[model samples]
Target: MNDDLKQAAGISFIEQTTLDRATIRTAYRPDYGAAPAYKSYPDAAVLELPRAAWQLSEARIINLLQRRRSLRTFAETPVSLHQLAFVLWASQGVTALAGNHLLRTAPSAGALYPIETYVSLQRVEGQASGIYHFDTRAFQLRLVVEGDQGSGLAAAFLGQQFLGQASFCLVWTAVSRRSMGKYGDRGVRYLLLDAGHICQNALLAAEAVNLGSCPAAAFYDRELNDLLGIDGYEEIALYGAAFGAKQETTTPLAGR
Candidate 1:
């Protein structure tokens, strides 16, 4: 185990990337002119979502927060298109456009949304199981790979079969250059933070819709990136979550 955690492992790499006053004083240089163009797939077939068709329950924020739990098991029932749309909206739906940037449901550093949203569906209402990309610009779903992908993704996650049991799983990938071009090394740090903000919104949204929710992070990076059809360097998987009808096995808040 000690040999496996050699000095040149991930911790060392992350430490090297940490931005500090001294490091910035000597090594910081940013080119503000660079901005990432919007991402899309023109060739993929699109499905416009029925946004706001399903209302988030009247549950208050405090209750939702209190009830939020990482549900590990889910029912076999399919997730509705409306529920999926709301979850996406809660995570990355564009609320407005400012100049060239699109402001979303979650806050982003410098309005640079380097994160992209994708879905792996095992079962969904009015949609076939497949890999789909959420195009925030048009509020549409682009079919990336047709047919079920949960099993393959489950394999990449080292046999975390529970992921394959959900109605669908949302995967977030980061385009680091989008943030780094403006803030230099600091922007790289923002990429991970942005992902956290987005996924948290998703988890809360799941609670609002009465769906089971669980965040997923353990996965083989290269294999997952390959499944998403993105090069491991330019775009990489950062976070994910499984959501479906509640087959929950959780206790109430402890000693409130």
Candidate 2:
């Protein structure tokens, strides 16, 4: 039978490596002090994020979905700190303490939340423009590399000018050590899936706030890693998105 023959034949090297590349990518990299499961900065000055409201808008699921669009254009207006916090929380905020792990708005394999969020703030009110690491445990922003990074990020994204014009950018990096330590090669797949969940939440949250956002994966890998100052070996930049206020030219909601 075809089923029997298929079972007898094993996966080709191409097939195997394709699925396992995520783990192999980091496995070959020289160990970088084995990143801890939960990443946070103890020394950096932290900006306390206001507790985000649960009901940011009265939008229903249908409305949020219909309004969602991958907008490239953005207004020059500065997004408020509160608005930023709400979007950040919706994306990867810690919701509950589930024993040893903290449950978030998105789920992860084996509850190993391997994705760490970093942001480049370009025009957030009352916040300096710089690279900041989100401290999910404490709900705060820890300053990492300070100063405007719009131009540099735009270059890393292959001259995607829209990135530089956005109010802020959310960079999601996968600390593979957290997942690969347990799940091995399979964990890499989990990391990619987790990023999608987090990004989608961001999109919906942006719509609720009437902000424009575009999730982007087409970027130069090493360049982006260097931009974020993370080792491309262990903590690799897997996905990201640019967010800002909506410009008049942004596409309107679907009429369906």
lDDT of 2 by residue, 177-197 (tens): 687667766667787899999
Judged by lDDT against the true structure, how good is candidate 1?
Answer: 0.82
lDDT of 1 at 67: 91
Query: TM-score of model 2 relative to the true fold?
Result: 0.75
Q: Across residues 1-256, which tens digit of lDDT does each residue of candidate 1 receive?
A: 2332224233234434433333445875565786668888889999999744545563377667889999878887888999998999999989988999889999999998999999997888878899999999899989999999999988777668988888999999987668766786677678889999999999999988999899988776667888999865556687899999996457689899
The C-alpha lDDT values of all candidates are: 0.82, 0.81
Clashing pairs in 2: none
Q: 243, model 1: CA deviation in Å? A: 0.5
